[model samples]
Target: MDTILIVNPKGGSGKTTLVTNLAGYLARQGEMVNLIDTDKQKSSIAWLKHRSPHLPTIFSTHTHNFANFSVKPSWSIIDTPAGLNEEILKKLLKKVDLVIVPIQPSFFDFQATQSFLEILNTKKPIRKGQTSVALVGMRVHPRTITAQQLEDFLKRQGFPIFTYIHDAQIYLQMASKGFTLFDLSPAKAKTHIEQWQPITEWIQNAHKI
Candidate 1:
């Protein structure tokens, strides 16, 4: 299975949003996807409970029983909790093929992400190029100073910034119903889908690397 880890040391950085949406997209494409929630809040797992039977299936299991899946999955997406410790983070980093770090455009978020990225760089998988790391800007507004600053900060971190997902009520609305942009019609979610293009493409390419 291709494993993708979504992480941010700061809370409210849109980790759950990215996790569910990516799983939804893969499921829509006829891939069996598994979601692993490491957050004590269990927000991602709770979202799974709210998913309608009509939508694509995304299987999930507790963090401890990660290898106990009944159905083998093509993709596994992990939603990590905030304030993750170095030892645990290193353990999780060793097995994943990719790491996607999302940050809201702000000073505090930037500082926290910077520190986290430093830690990532020191990991064996990352230093040896066994795991790919990328960044995504969450709740960004184009042409804003903070957004531009965020882009600049991330660019300087020596990792690619796949895309910047703008602030949209649609994400919140869909999450309430256990839905993602992929579940919406093209006309209804065109812009957001466009933003996700680079992210999905990177995942596909990461498998090759």
Candidate 2:
């Protein structure tokens, strides 16, 4: 199974949004997906509860144990807690194929992400290139100064920025319904779906270690 870890030490960085959508995308593509919620708040778990029976199946276990799954999963998406300690991050990194850090375009978020990235770079798996890391700009408005600043800031970190997801109420609406852009008709979510293409492509191409 391929594992993807969505992490950011800063809270409200859109980690849960990315996790649910990514899991939904994978499930929509007919991949067997396991959703893991490591956050104390159980946001991902709550979202799973809201998932409709007609939608593509995504499995989860309350114990957070990968071995105990309802069905064997081809993909595992882990939503991590905020302020994650180095010891736990290290352990999680060892098992993941990719790490996605989502950040809102704000000064405080940028500062917190910068510090997190510093520690992330020092992890053994990352230093050895065994696991790949990427950034995503969340809740951004296009052609705005804040968006430009986010691009500038992330570029300096020397990691790939897959795409910028704009500030849209659609995400909230979908999340509330246990859905993602991928779960909707193409006509309704074309733009957002296009924005996620790079991320999907990267997931397909990323080597599992």
Candidate 3:
């Protein structure tokens, strides 16, 4: 099974949003997707509770201690807590296939993201290529000064920015409804889901690892 870890020691950085939407996308594609919420906030669990039964199935679990991990599926999406410590991150990285750090295009979250990336780079798995890591900028407006600043910052850090999610209220609306753009009719969500194509492609290709 492939494991994807969405982590950033910064609150309101869109970690849960990334986890649920990606889970929805994978499940809709008929992949056996399981979402594990490790955050104390239990945001993913709340979203699961609101998920419509009519939609495609996505098995989920909420665990604070990170134990009793026995279920296996095509994809395992783990959402970590904000302000996570390096020791715990080290443990999580040992089992992850890919690590996705979601951040907003703002100075408010930049410090935390930079510090977290530094710690991630030091982890044995990431350094040894036992796991791959990528960055995703969420709620961004392309061509704006903020966006340009974000791009410049990432470029200096030497981290690949796989994609940028446009700043759209529809994503917030979808979360309240327990659905992702992928759950909507292709025509309705065409643009939003298209923004996620790079992420999906990376995840799909990462399955080989």
Give candidates' CA RMSD values in order.
Answer: 1.9, 2.2, 1.1
1 against 2, candidate with superior lDDT: 1
Candidate 2 minimal-lDDT segment of 10 residues: 63-72
For each candidate, how many residue pairs have backbone atoms clashing (under 3 Å)?
A: 0, 0, 0
> Each prediction's Cα lDDT score?
0.89, 0.88, 0.88
Report how far residue 25 has shifted in candidate 3, in Å.
0.8
- Per residue, candidate 3 scores C-alpha lDDT tens digits across 91-169 of 7877778999998988978888888888888888888888888899999998999999888877766668889899998
The reply for model 2, stretches above 4 Å from the true place, is 63-72, 207-209
Q: Write the per-residue lDDT of candidate 2 for residues 1-209, one digit (tens) a residue.
A: 78898999899999999999999988998988998888778999998899998999888744444334332478988898888888788778877889999999999999999999999999888888888999999999999999999999999998889999999999889877889888899899999888889888999887333
On lDDT, the leading prediction is 1
- lDDT at 13, model 2: 95
Give candidate 1's TM-score: 0.95
**What are the runs in model 3 whose C-alpha is more than 4 Å off?**
none
| lDDT-based ranking | 1, 3, 2
Native-referenced Cα lDDT, model 3: 0.88
Q: For each candidate, give its TM-score against the true structure.
A: 0.95, 0.94, 0.96
Give the clashing pairs for model 3: none
